[model samples]
Each structure stands twice: as structure tokens, then as C-alpha cells.
Target: MNTNSTEYRLEGDGASIQSLPKISLHDHLDGGLRPQTLIELADEQGLEVPAADADGLAAWFTEQSNSGSLVEYLKTFDLTTAVMQTRAGLARIAREFVHDLAADGVIYGEIRWAPEQHLARGLTLDEAVEAVQEGLEQGADDVRHQGGGIRTGQLITAMRHADRGLEIAELAVRHRDRGVVGFDIAGAEAGFPASRHRTAFDYLASQFMPVTVHAGEADGLESIRSALFDGRALRLGHGVRIAEDLLIERQDDENTYVSLGPVAQWVRDREIALETSPSSNLQTGAITAWGDELVDHPFDLLYQLGFRVTVNTDNRLQSGTSLTRELALLSDAFGYDLDDLETFQLNAAAAAFLPLDDRDELAELIQDGFDEA
Candidate 1:
């Protein structure tokens, strides 16, 4: 992404957004590499790159990802994952991912990626998870030695178009005690509903594992419904299209009457978190139903209706953004202040895959950080 930038602060009071404690729920491990690091890793593997230098590569990613199509945006990952086929490559990328998150003031993050995509390098599924864990530990240790603190966990993902959901779910459960915190299903959310992975979902439920399904992005409400009923998802990855269930009855100068359909009502009443990535949503045409601008996003609508809304950077490298930058964009779009930002972080903390005590600790930490700022 664009790494050369000044600090981001609130508009009026100039409160530093980068200094505030934040939590990341939807960040992808393969989607957050530094451009220079990608160049070096690709060179080591004799992989061909689209651009020669870091600046050129970063610009290429930005131009390619702005095509307003999820499939096109995903094509950029082929380059990133190609260089990540070896143990050393995976470890180095994951370690740098953590360091970058820490530098952006992320106190905790759940890094998601598909291990099945990495097995072309002769590593078993178990070995792939172990390599990522080793890197996460090393990154955390490096942060501690620098007088900073950061925590991270893995969210093992199964490609929705693939047929390894059951096996991937098993891998997540096997590593739950190590560093794996949750399970997820991603990729091509159109025809592949979560119901296709009913067997995996049943197994995960039997083991009492937490799940977050990518829905309401490329598809509509039925996809989200399947995620909830079939996949038993506790949170929705980029569940922005649940807005389709919202019915705006009438509008006037001062107030507008609105009604909620079953899906939106259930998500709101049950407090199922919506992991909304503003820029990624725009890039993928997820918000085209509403409009084509950041201010036109349904994020403010979801937040106003009291949905458990959390801000995220779905793919930092693809979107050319960070958690801090995402929050700033939202604040600028909706005129939100520090209290609004704090509420978003608190929502993410509540919806985290950690235990109740740990979630409470995170909430307190967030509140303390915002208060101090």
C-alpha cells in the first residue's frame, strides 16, 4: 500500500486516530505485504512480477484493484501467494504483517488466509499453520522488545469455490489451542452458499468452534441467510448487503420512516457483527446499490439502526488502506467523533472470538486508550 503518509487525526480536535487502540477482524494475511518485501520474495523464487520496483508495484496494485470488481481484485493475490509457497516466505510475510499492524496502532488482529492455497510448495496443511504461528510469535516478540504490545490470532479460511471445508474446519479445531482462533469461508460468494459446507459447519458446531462467513458482499440476503442458518456464522464478513433487507418507507425534510425485513431485524436484534470494509466494499461494487461514493455507503445507515457494526480493512494491499485510514474515511464521510470511533472498536471487541474475560479486557483497553487520547 501507500506507506509514505503523515499521521491521521480527527477534523476538529485533531485527536490522533493512529494513536488510538484498534482491533482488526477482517484483515487478510496475504493481502497486507509490504511492496518491497513482495519484490524480494518474488525475486528469491524466480517469480515474475508485474512491476520492477516497490513504488511501481504499489501503483500497479492500486490501479488494478480499482476496477470495481471482486474477481479482478482477487487476481492480484496470485502474485502474493506465488511467492508465499515456502515456509520461509510465509513466515517472513506474516511477521511483517504483524509489524505493520502494530505500527498502525492495532492492539489485536485476527489474520485470515487459506492454507490450501499454499500447499503447492510441498508443505502439509499442519506445517503451513505451524509456519504462520511461528511468524506471529516472532512478530509479537519483536514488538515487545520495542516497548510496544500487539496480539494476533489466525482465522483459518476455506475457499468457497473449493471442496475442502470439512478438512479446513478440522485443521482450525486442531490448532485452536495453538494460535487458531476461528474458522471462515471466503472466495466467490455468488453461487457457493454456506449451505454447501453444511457438513463442515455441523462439525464445527459439534466442536463448539466459532465461525465468520463472508456473505452479503458478492451475493445478497439469501447468502447471508445461509451463512447464519447453515454455516452458523457468529459474524458476517463484509455483510454490507443486509441493507437490501431494509425498507425505506418514506422520506421528508427532517425524518425518514424505514422498516426492516427479517434478515436485517435478526442481525440487529441478535447483535451479529457486520465486519464492514468501506474501501473494499466500494472497490468490489458491494455498495453500488446505494451509490458510488464513500458518503453514500450504508455504513452510517447500519450504525444508525443499531446494528453491531465494525470497521475493517479487508485487504490493505489491495485497498491501499489501513485500519486507521478506514476509520478516518468513515469519520470524514459521516461526521463522526471520538465516541463513534470508540463504539466501533467496542463492537469489534465484543464480537471477537476470544473468551468473555478477554473481550472485556479489550473493551477496557480501548476505552482507556480513547480517554487518554
Candidate 2:
């Protein structure tokens, strides 16, 4: 609805990718802060920052995230979360996050963050949730005033290395009627499989709360299996490493024959959506098993193999990307066109944690937007 032209466009026909209605399922609240906002928040908190100006701060985050170590990549969040310890900071960040997503043409988005990480200033978990919800509502209202529409929900995350899974799960369910839509477990995924939070997952299962797990990004198929079997994840967060299960038996000039292992078979057959973030995946080396380049990502392979694939910006600020930019990059790498982009949005809309009727409405909205484009 924002008619401003974006730098990202489809390569072949030059269609504006940014104007298309999109869904964001894997975006992190702490990782998507505006650089300028970070600078101001840090100044208010009397905290030291890596850069003096907004541009320098932005570059700093990008550089640190691309350091080829997940631990180093996660350190950037320390700066972000450092300034987000108060209600005003959290609400302002959430409000600005929604505004940025709306400007990028995100019609529906689910912002995920861990509340425990924001408790340093003595804010209760419920207060944190309420603050974010207030900001989201204010942001949505602002968009509506501008003659645009956007919807959002919070995905309360429990750090995988922490022991607050059950508490976070309960927190999410407690706010389900207010703003929270689902529960997720993020952080290190190798040794900290979803099984470590089995009690929380079991409780969420009993309550029928939708779940998504951050598996297959830093780990492999077994981790994904635990997310499915133990976490009962309805969707996977950056489940790109599931590509390991695809055995490429042979390849020709135009055709490639592949065998799907049980994990791959189950994921594809069951239509589990893979929240693939192209820029972030490359920066974090999540695609290293295939190659180091975007072209080496298994997105195209999975898309061709009938795997439910969706495009996302896992961390917009750290990756220096938007959903539009991610889609354009994928298009440049894999020669995708408007229809392919639309398919990714449709997949995301269908995979959203909303009711079936709401999902259908989202699908219709996406179709209409694509048709206009």
C-alpha cells in the first residue's frame, strides 16, 4: 500500500517485489531493531555501543553476524537487548518494527522474542508481553490511519540453553487471547534439542497451542526429528539443514534424480514449511553443508521437490535485508519469477498459526496483491 519504489525488484520484468503482500514467520524482535533507535536507546541507558552513528552501528551488526561463528553472531543481540530492558524501550522497538514491516509490505507477521532476556530491569513477564502488545496495536492503528492494513502476533520464545521452557510456554498461552499466537524455542540447536524442553512441549501439546521450533539451522536431521517428535512443532524455523536428507542419486543437464530419506520424506509429505532466510542463512553459514553462496542454498532444490518453502528475513537488521531483498536475492540466484514469489507467500500464509478462515483470508489477500502486481 506504500507506493514508494523499492530498490529490490524482479530481475527479468522488474516488478516491485517490495509492494507485494508478504508474511514474515521467522523474524526476531531483538534482531530487527533500527540502528538509529539502538543508538538513542543506548544513549538513554548510558551504555557503550560499538559505533558512534547509525550507519556505523548498522555496519557493525552486519560485520559481527558474518563472522562465521554462531556465538559471535549472537553477541550482536547483547547490544540490542541491552537497551530493551524497559517498557518504553520495548514498546518503541515493537512499534517501529511494525512500521518497518509495513513499509516493506508485510501484510502479516509473527514477531518472536524471549521475555526472559528482557527481564533484567525487573519487568515481569506479563508486563513485557503487555507492553509489546500495546506497541503492536498502536503500530497497526498507525498503518490503518495511513490507509494500509497489517496484522501481527507474538511468538514467545524460550531460550534453548535456558530452563524456562515451561514458564515461557505458559506465558504464551496466558496471552494467547491478547496478542501471543504461538510458542517457540530458539538459541543453540546442536546439543540443546527440543527434547530438553519436553515437559513444556508436552504441556503446550495438551493445551493445543501451536508450536514452531528453531531446528535444522545449526544442527542436522536428528535435531529436526526431535523438534517434530518431542516438540510437536507445527512449523520449523529455518529448517534448511533438512536438506541433508536429500540423497542426490544422479544429475543430468536438465534433470536431477534424488532419493528422499525418511526425514526428508516426512517433512515434504507432511507439508512442513521451511522458513528459509537467504541472506541470514548465508551469513550464519547455515548453508555450508551445500555451499557458501546463496546459489548453493537448497531452496531451489526443495522448491522443485515439492517441499513447502517460504522466504523470510530471520534478522532484518543483522542481515541488512528485508523480505523483499531476500526474495530478490533468491530470484537472482534461482531465476524465480513473480509466480514463484507468490507461491512462497502463499506457503507462508497457509502455514501461519492463525485459524483456517484467517489463513484463507490471507491467501486471498496475497493472491489479489500478486494479481495487481
The candidate that achieves the highest lDDT relative to the unseen native structure: 1
Candidate 2 stretches greater than 4 Å from native:
1-6
C-alpha lDDT score of every prediction, in listed order: 0.94, 0.92
- What residue runs in model 1 are displaced by over 4 Å at the alpha carbon? 2-4
Model 1, residue 94: what's the lDDT? 91
Clashes per model (N, Cα, C within 3 A): 0, 0
Residues 64-91, model 2: lDDT tens digits? 8997656677888988999989999999
Q: What are the per-residue Cα lDDT tens digits for candidate 1 across 127-235?
A: 9999999999999999999999999999999999999999999999999999999999999899999999999999999999999999999899999999999999999
Residue 98, model 1: Cα distance from true site in angstroms? 0.6
Candidates in order, TM-scores: namely 0.99, 0.98
Candidate 1 vs. true structure, TM-score: 0.99
